[model samples]
Target: SEMMIMANWLMARFLSERNLPAIFRSQPDPKERLYNEDQGTLFQNWMQRRLLSRFVLSSRSERHSGLGLNAYLTATSPIRKYFDLVTQRQIRSAFDLDTPYTDREIERSLHSLEQPMFSVSRLQYQRKRYWLLKYLEERIGKKEEALVLNRRRNGYQVLLTEYLTECMLPVSSGVSMRSEDMIQVTIQHVNARKDTLSVYMA
Candidate 1:
C-alpha cells in the first residue's frame, strides 16, 4: 500500500507537470485531529478515522491531504478500477505510446461514474455490516466484553472486543463510563435489514 501510494503520487506529479489530463483523486484535510503521532491506541485510531474527509475525483490536480501528497491518483490497480486504467493510459501517453484523454473527456468520465461508484461502495459496506450483525444476532443473550470508544449525549459508543463490531449502549442518566473503559454488555436486539442493533449493560 505504501509503495502504491508513492507510485501514484509520483505519477500524479509527473502528469500534472506535463499538463496531461488524468483523473486525479483529492482529499481535503480531516475535519479535526485526534492524535499527532503515528503510533496510537485502537481507540485513538478509531477517533481519527471518524474525522477523515472523503476523497473526491477531479480532472485537474489537487492536494490529497489524507495521503500527505500535493497530487495523487491510483494508477497501480488498472484491473480493479476504471480511473486507475485511465491514469495508466495517461502515463502511457507521456511515453508516446497512447493517446491522452482530453480534460473534458476525463470530466465526463468522472461524472458518469459518480453514481455507480457510490452504489457499489454502499452495497459493499452494507453487505459486510449485515453479516456482522447477523453473527451478533445468533449470539444474542450472551454477555460480551466491549470497550467504550466515546460517550454520546444519549448513550455510549462501544466496540465488542470479540467481533470488533460497534454498537450503541444506552445508559441511565446517572451511569458513568469513560472512553477506553471495558464493560460487560448484553446484546438485546439486532435487525440486519433495518441496520439496527441494541445493547445494554450486563
Candidate 2:
C-alpha cells in the first residue's frame, strides 16, 4: 500500500513538473467523494468518475475532472502504451520545431485505436478470469466468502476476496443483497477450460 501511494505521488509530481499533457487515471466511482469542499469544488466531484473509463488520451485537453489538472496527456511510457508513444513523438517534434504526423494521420489513428484497446482489455480480463477459474476448480468445496457487488433477480454477483474475481453466487437468501456486503459462500464447482464457476452462499 505504501508503494502504491508513493508511486502515485511520484507520478503526479513528474507530470506536474513536465507540464505535459499526459493521461491521468481517475477514481472509479463517479459519485464517490474523496475530498472536502476545503480541497476544491472540482476535486471532490472528480473523485467520483474513477473506474468509469480506461485510459483517456486527449492531445487536446489536459483537464481531467478527477486529476484536477489544467492539461494532461498520456506520454508516460512508450512501450507499455501506444498512446504514450504517440504523444511523446508529438511533444518531441514540437520541441524541435516540427510536426511528427500529418493532421489526417492523427485523425486516422484516433479512429483505429479505440477498437484495438477495447479488444485488448477484453482479452486480458478473460485471460485472468480463466486462470482464476482454474485455481477455483482445484479448490472446489472449500468454504469462502464474497463481497456483494450487484444483486440479480435470480442470484447475486459477488467478488471473491481470495481470488480478487467476481462471480455469481447462486443463492440470494430471499433478499436484495446490498453492495459491499460480506456474504459467506462456498465454491461449488469450476470449469477452467470453459471459464465458468458455480458458487453458493454458505
Candidate 3:
C-alpha cells in the first residue's frame, strides 16, 4: 500500500514537472482525476480485455500450479504471516513425533493460508493496474488507429495504438461496428469508475 501511494505521488510529480499530457493532474491531497469519463471506461475495458486475452487464451503450461504436498507446504510462509507460522509449527510437531500430519490436515492448512495470500496479491495487482491506466489516460482524446482482436456478444475488443493495451468498444457505448475493421478511436472514457476509449472506422 505504501509503495503504491508513493508511486502515485511520484507519477504526479513527474507529470507535472515534465508538462506531460495525461488524463489527470496531481492534487495536493493525492486525489486523481481521470480527465474524462470515456477515458476511464476505456481503461477499464483495456484491462479486462488484456486480462482475458492473457489468461483465457494463454497456453496451459504458462499457468501457475503447485506440484503436490511439497509444493503446498513450501507455499506457506513461516515468517510475517501468522497462519503460515502456525501451520509450520503443526507440521514440525508431527514430523518430530515420527507421525506426519494426515493429508486432510495438510490440505486444510494450505487452504487456510490461501485467503490472505490471495488478498495481498490482488491488492498489489489492482494498484499496478490503476497506475498503468493512469499512464494511458494521459493520452486521452488522441486519435489512434487500432486492430480488432475479438468480437464479443456486446462489442469488439481492440488493440490500441499503443502496444499490448486492449480496450473494448461496447455496442452499448455507441460504437456499432464489426470485427477486424481498422478504426480511429478518440478516447471517450477515463475515470475512477471506468477506463475505456471510443472508436469508429476511419
Maximum-TM-score candidate: 1
Best candidate according to lDDT = 1
Please give the clash total of every predicted structure, in order. 0, 15, 25
Candidate 3: regions farther than 4 A off: 1-102, 161-163, 170-184, 193-202
Better of 2 and 3 by TM-score: 2
Error of 2 at 47 (Å): 14
Sort all candidates by TM-score, best to worst.
1, 2, 3
Model 2, residue 198: C-alpha shift (Å): 1.1
Candidate 2 residues lying further than 4 Å off, grouped into runs, are 1-56, 65-70, 172-179
**lDDT against true structure, model 1:** 0.90
Q: TM-score for candidate 3, please give it.
A: 0.42
lDDT of 3 by residue, 148-169 (tens): 7677876788877564566776
Per residue, candidate 2 scores C-alpha lDDT tens digits across 25-135 of: 333233445565366432223323442444464333434555554444444467998776766665566566555655566557767787897899999988888887877
